[model samples]
Target: MFKTIKNDLPASIVVFFVALPLCLGIALASGAPLFSGLIAGIIGGIVVGGLSGSKIGVSGPAAGLAAIVLTAIGTLGGYENFLVAVVLGGIIQILFGILKAGVIGYYFPSSVIKGMLTGIGIIIILKQIPHFFGYDADPEGDFAFFQVDGENTFSDLYKTLKFITPGSALIGFIGLGILILWEKVLSKKGKIFQLVQGPLVAVVVGIVFYAVTQSNEALSISQSHLVSVPVPEDTASFLGQFSFPNFSAITNPDIWIVAFTIALVASLETLLCVEATDRLDPHKNVTPTNRELLAQGTGNILSGLIGGLPITQVIVRSSANIQSGGVSKMSAIIHGFFLLISVILIPRLLNMIPLSVLAAILLVVGYKLAKPGLFKKMYDLGWKQWIPFNVTVLGIVFIDLLWGIGLGLAVGIVVILLKSYQNSHFLHIEDKSNGKHRISMTLAEEVTFFNKGAILKELDSLPRDTFLEINLLKTRYLDNDIIEILEDFLYKSKERNIDIKLVSKRGIVENPSSFIKFFNERPKSEMSLS
Candidate 1:
């Protein structure tokens, strides 16, 4: 990890710039203390990054958990009481890690996962539009279709257009221009450009822009449109910002309910992010999922004890880390330290940077994730993959993150069942000289209850004067439900005057009186074709 510091240091700075506003925005959206978001960011980076198996994944306050945190805090009676639930949730996540529940991440369909990344990308782009124009009504990092402020995503954009801050819009455009030039033109020119990332340049330019325009009433960006970090007057007051959990709240049954909910949601979001970050990793490194969960659990526990919102492996920060050329976990750790040091020493300076600058940086990140090429790529994969992928993206855009994933997963499962039903058996029809129809049905390699419907349909469709051959020579396992279907079909075969030949690895039997008895009594070698 130390070997990559040359690359990691620069990348960490970029991630710090990216994570700072997000940490505050998510906290603002959650109705939690703004400083709590910074605490989660610090612990997520230092503690989780140290213990996690992921080289690129960065843990922090997740936008995905904002809604949950907001509601839980209200339900728990107070922010201090909510801290109790967060700590308990962390404990539960640790137990989940111990039980190796991280394997659940693998069960999600690839299409859905990709859809999630693309969906989130689109959401980022849409949500940042208002902020990019300096519309400060809706908090940054709130990605839900319906916002807590009673304004929807599109309505906020409309409102932003009506009340655009000239100073903010001007700086936002300048910041965007600098970022584009840095990436597309300047970076290739020299090492200096590469070391000094586009975002850092944009931030510096934004600060200068704000300072220069301060006296101009129409051009000056307001405090609402700037980065807001809690300014501590002295060291003691700075430390005073951290709050301890109300442990007595643990006795409340409601606290445990909230705890379990947080544990479940945070663990799921972390697992999904782990998978996404691994996919986004240029080196194709695979993260140990269980270890990630354990690390996150520990981070959440620490964060809660110190008055922080819940922590998860957030895709936003992780993606920013990867895109900014983060090569190791050190980048994440360094970024955490940056957050710690900046808040302590240069918070007022940080507060001077325009939110529009960060919005510009995130706009680029969002574009990368939801590039037009991805949609075309998914479409070319065929409906089996594309439908679920499209549904997931749409669901995430129109609804919330978890619900979108669930909707996509449900669609993916349905697609799998359809494929299973279709591939269960292959039918080949033959005509004999006597006008009798001969149908040969070959069972799939593995037969389960999902195949029962397809098999029964073919059996029931047999003509009155037909010969049916059911072949299972390729089958490895057959479900009891299918076996029962086959048994019941035998009685139907008699009424239809159909002669049945059941062929298996054991042997062949013709018009078996009792299908079960024939299979049970016959030895593999002794059975004869008759």
Candidate 2:
């Protein structure tokens, strides 16, 4: 892991800059103590990173869980009560890992996964717009369409025009310019430029800008629009910030319910992030999904013990890590250390950095993820892929993260069923021969119950005085539902004056009396000609 330290070190700094405000913002969004988010970030990075098999994936307090955490805290009675749930949730996650349930992540369709990444990118872009203009009405970690502020995603954008802070907006543009310059020009010029990332530069400039303009009333950035890390006056107060879980609350059934909920949701979100992060990695390294669950479980347990929010492998931080050239788990561990050391040593300095700079950095990240070219690429894959992709994207924009993926997955399943229906059988018709219409229907390989409707519909549509040939030579395994349908069709064929012939590898049968009995007498295990 240390072999790539040169790359990982720089990437870790970038991720550190990215994760800082997010930790604070998600905690704020969850209505938990501000320090709790930072704690989650620290534990997610160090503990989870140490145990995880992912080379470039980063874990943290996820924005996707903000709503769940918020309600869990209130429903459980208090933050201390909520801590018990988080710990239990971690245990549940560990069980999930031990059970080897990580394979469930592989069931998600590629189209849905791509749609998820694109939707998140678009959300990041939309959510950051207001912050870029210095309107801080919404927390940076609130990614849902409906917000706790009662002003939804779009409404906040409309309101931004009325409340934009002049100083923050100016500095935001400057920060964006710096990032763009580094990405498109400066970074390409030298190894030194690559070592010192653009986001780190923008953050430094933002801090300097805020410090210098503090005296100018018209240009001074307000504390409200800056990163808000809780400042501890001394060691005692700092240590006091940590809260312990209420063990008495463990007996409460509600705590168990909340714990199960967190375990399920956090595991799901982590699995999804692992899938997406692997796709984003330049080296295309595959992370052990089960190991990731175990790592997250351990992180959440430690985080809960110390009064922190629940942890999950976060796509935003992971993607930022990969894009910034992170090649090992060390980047994640280093970022956690940065979070811990900074909050302990220089939280005051962190508070001075403007939020607009971070927003600017996210805007670029968002753009890269949702680049217009991806739309065309997905579309070119045809409606089977395009419909689900678009549906997922729209659902995510209009609803929330998980819902979007769910909607997309639903659409994708429907598309698969439709394709199955069409491909179940190949029907070829010939003009009148021997004073009768002739139709040949060939069943597909491995026909299942899903193909019953299509086959039945075709059989029912046969004309009177038609000669129908049922070809099962290509079919390896025929579903019982379809066999029943074919048996029932025998009665209809006689009534319609339709002559029937069954063609198979065994032999030709003239209007077989019983489809089931015919298959039962033959070799059942291997139905194919070969």
Candidate 3:
């Protein structure tokens, strides 16, 4: 861990800048007190990072949980009321961890996971477009195509086209230009650019531009362009910003519903981040899934208790961490410190940085995630890889996040079963010379109930005047459903001139006992005879 810290120091700064706006944006989107988002970011970084076994996974306030938190706050009558559920959620998460539920995250297919990252990348790009144009209504794309206020991404973009602010848009373009310059030219200049992060430069330039443009005489940047951490006057005023949880609202069924919602979403988002972050790690360190859950669970509990929004291992921050060259948990911890120290030391300075600068940075991150090359690479692998990947991406882009993954997983499962079903049901038909047609049903190595439909379909379609040989020589185990299917087919075989021959371990059974009785009476060796 210490060695990783030394190697990833540069990456940590990049993650810090990337995470800063996201923390505030997600907080703003969640409708919780602004401090709650910062607090969640702090805990996700320090606490979750400390406890998480993954080398590169940076934890924070998830955009995925914004809807849940927003709904929870409203249903609970106040943000404070939602806090209790968050704590409960954390406890439940810890219990989940103790029960070793973390293993569940590992079982998802790689294609599905990659699809998820790519899908999220596209969402981030779509969501950030509004903010880059300085439209700050919705919390930077909380996973819906349509907004609760009835203005969705497309509508918002249309609105931006209709009413673009001159100052904000101009500054936004400048910010984007600077970022591109940093990434393309300046970043390649070696040690100096490595030492000075691109986002940090964009943010600084944004602040200087804002400070100079404060007066409307020569330059007029509106409020929409600025970073929106609520401006508190003094230290006591800052502390006054906290929202107390509604303990009475804790018993409300809606709160529990919200809790379950948060838990499921946060867990899934965390798991997805864990998968994506591990891939991005330069060292290729594999983090323990159970440990991550426990860490996130604890972070959520703390966040809820402190009137902060729910936290999860977010991919935005994790990807930023990886791209920034973060190699160790230290980058995570350091970024948390940045979140904590900045909120306390320079609320005024933070308020000066434009949302456009952050948006510019995210645009870059988003582009990297959803790059054109990724599609071609996956497509080149063939349909088995392409179908699920594209399906997942399309599902996420058009529908909700989890729903997309679910649809993809469902497709993947169906594909697998189709392959298995096709592989298992084997039939050989022959027209015999001596007024007999020989047919053989050679069962697969292991035949389960899934093969019942295929087997039955083939058998039902068989032509008349066929001699059937029931071969179970290669079969190690037969499902009870299949046995019943075979028994019922025997009566059907009589109708078609299908002379039946049963092959088993004990040479050959001329007229085998009843399906159940034969299996019960026959020794294992006898049933398995070749």
TM-score of 2: 0.95
Clash counts for all predictions: 0, 0, 6
Inter-residue clash pairs, candidate 3? 11-324, 80-244, 80-245, 80-246, 81-246, 505-529
Query: Model 3, range 324-440, lDDT digits (tens) per residue?
Result: 777778989988898888888887788788777788888888888888899999999878788888888888877767877888888888777787788775788755767777778
lDDT of 2 by residue, 175-268 (tens): 9999999999999999999999999999999999999999999999989999999999999999999999998989999999999999999999
- lDDT, residue 305, candidate 2: 97
Local error of candidate 2 at 463, Å? 2.0
List TM-score per model, in order.
0.95, 0.95, 0.89
C-alpha RMSD of each candidate structure in angstroms: 2.9, 1.9, 3.2
lDDT of every predicted structure (CA atoms): 0.91, 0.92, 0.79
lDDT leader: 2
lDDT of 1 by residue, 65-101 (tens): 8998899888888999999999999999999999999
Candidate closer to the true structure by TM-score (higher is better), 2 or 3: 2
In terms of lDDT, the poorest run of 10 residues in model 2 is 521-530
Q: Once superposed on the true structure, which residue ranges of model 1 sit more than 4 Å away at CA?
A: 433-435, 512-530
C-alpha lDDT of candidate 2 relative to the true structure: 0.92
